[model samples]
Target: MRNLKRLSIGPIDLDVAGGEIIALTGPSGAGKSLLLRAIADLDPNEGQLSLSGEDRNAISAPAWRKQVMYVPAHTGWWADTVEPHFADLSRAHVKNTLQRLGLESTALNWQVANLSTGERQRLALARAMAHEPKILLLDEPTSGLDSENAARAEKLISEIAKSGTGIVFVTHDVAQAERLGTRRLYFYNGGLHEAAP
Candidate 1:
């Protein structure tokens, strides 16, 4: 596949493939998140964005969203206990994800209000993984964690990518990108620049 033409926002372009992790990095206001939104059809834009040879616009929003999920920087929690939020989740999968993220199984019963930011982040990651989306849109998912927790989170991401999920990860942390991404894309001036090897 070829990179689409530069969007109106600026002069960058990107060509992405399936089962590949593409890290997006740039300064703030550089439109990294905006680019993800545009690709996910959560924002207005003029250009071609396709998945598996089908144009993004041709698919219904909900269907596209289910297949290509976007997890924002600040994940939302609307319940008291974490278990309630994941009540529909498969017990085995939930337990495994939490364990992989370094969370004890007991954390499932903890109140959302009582959990720290890192815990919340891990919970969000777990929630997203439970859905088994084909494409993952992550926005600074490891931003609020301690080094140890961040490393665990990174490992989880690596494992997920290895399972064939296409990940478009947006982060300011270059090292994290280098560790997790198989390919890299830089967002700037409201567009995308493909990183060189």
Candidate 2:
């Protein structure tokens, strides 16, 4: 991120190396999610963002977004069934991802209407990883999950990060930050205070 600024947060210049996880923690309105949104280019923000040294403006929005995926807390379910939401993925791939997230392979057959909030959260994460984004922006990915499911989510994401995808996530859970963050940034006084990785 270079000179990235948006919504009370800006001029954020940092390098998120491949295979690193940076956790953003702070009180409400401190712009933790806003900062993630800026880096992902989901919100209107000034400055530049580059991945592997490539400028963000050089690519189309859709293409750039494909590489830097942003997973919102509540993912949109435009289709009635889970399979349709992942129409781009083969059944095998979806099933593989389902199992990776601790769901049975047959979970692909479930209806979206029947999924609980936690299910949606996990499924949304699965969807995000399907494209293999170089940068993964997760907005409180495990807020809806119980401890077991949350741990499962963390493990899955950790695997992704280890595989060389940079991860930037927002979490209010300090323990979660300690567990998952390779580097932690505490948002305070409308600014960020950095901590060692």
Candidate 3:
């Protein structure tokens, strides 16, 4: 993104190379989520964004969003059952993702209302990964998980990036940022600044 500005953030310029993870950290209301939303085109903002050198404005919003998937912290679900929220679970990759997240395949058959907060977060991530996006904008992806599940999530994220997905994730855990970020960015005073690795 070049000169990306949202609400009170930016004129920001950033480039996330393939297989890279950029970790965002800051105080609450620092516009961290706003930056991700802008990049995903979920919120109105001024910017020039491109994917693999293709102009963002050149493609339709839905198409741009498909390639650059955004999975919010609390992902919205419109269905009563978990299966409806995702693509065909028969796919090997989808099943693999669920297993990797420590979720049983049967979880897909359960009611959405019955899930725990951490389960919801993991399922949301699994659903997002099913699309096989080139870039992922994640907002506090593991905030709801316990230590074990959080470690599983971090490993999965690292594996995904290794497979060439550019990722931008928001997190409060400084250690997690260091563990996953190829580069770390700190949001402060209405601007994003680089942080030491």
Candidate 4:
């Protein structure tokens, strides 16, 4: 990013390489989500965001968004059944993904109405990965899960990051950030600064 500034959050000039996770931590209402939204191009902002030499401005928003996927804290389910949501991607593609996130393979056969909040969260993560985005803008991806499921999510996400996809995640838990982020940044007062390991 070259002078990436979002709703008074930053002129954050960031360079994230593939296989790296950059964690953003901050107090509540400190524009952490705003920054992620700006990076995802979901909101209006100023910046030069590029990926693998492709300029964000040069590409269409929909196309750019396809490559840089954003998964929000509150996920939306539009289908009546779980399998329909993943029909194009196929259940087999995400079979291991569902299990990796502590969901059963039979979860593919479950109905959308039957899924709990935690199941929705895990399913959203799987959906995002199915697209195989070049970058992931994850906002509290495991906020709805229990401790056991959260650990599974963290581990699965770490493995996905290792596959050369850049990830920027926001979390209120400092410990969670430390565990997931290869580098960490503090967000406050509309500024971003490096955090100590």
User: Which candidate has the top score in lDDT?
Assistant: 3
* Per-prediction CA RMSD (Å): 2.8, 1.9, 1.5, 1.8
Candidate rank order under TM-score: 3, 2, 4, 1
Stronger candidate by lDDT (1 vs 4): 4
Error of 3 at 117 (Å): 0.6
Give the poorly placed runs of model 2, Cα more than 4 Å off. Answer: none
Query: Which 10 consecutive residues of model 4 have the lowest summed lDDT?
Result: 84-93
**lDDT per residue (tens digit) for residues 1-197 in model 3:** 89999999998999988899999999999899999999999999998999999999899999999889999999888899988877544567777899999998888898988889999999999988888789999999999999999999999999999999999999999999998899999998778889732
Worst 10 residues of 1 by lDDT: 1-10
Once all C-alphas are superposed, what RMSD does model 2 give against the true structure? 1.9
TM-score of 4: 0.93
| Model 3: residues with Cα > 4 Å off, grouped in runs | 88-90
Candidate 1 lDDT over residue span 1-197, tens digit each: 12333244543356555678899898887677766766666776666677788877788998888778888888888998999878877999989999999999899899988988889988898888877788889999999999999889888888888888888899898887788889877766565667623
Clashes of 2: 1
Give lDDT per model, in order.
0.80, 0.86, 0.91, 0.86
lDDT tens per residue, model 4, 9-119: 777888888899999888889998888888889999997999889888898999888788999998888888787777768567688788888888888778888889899
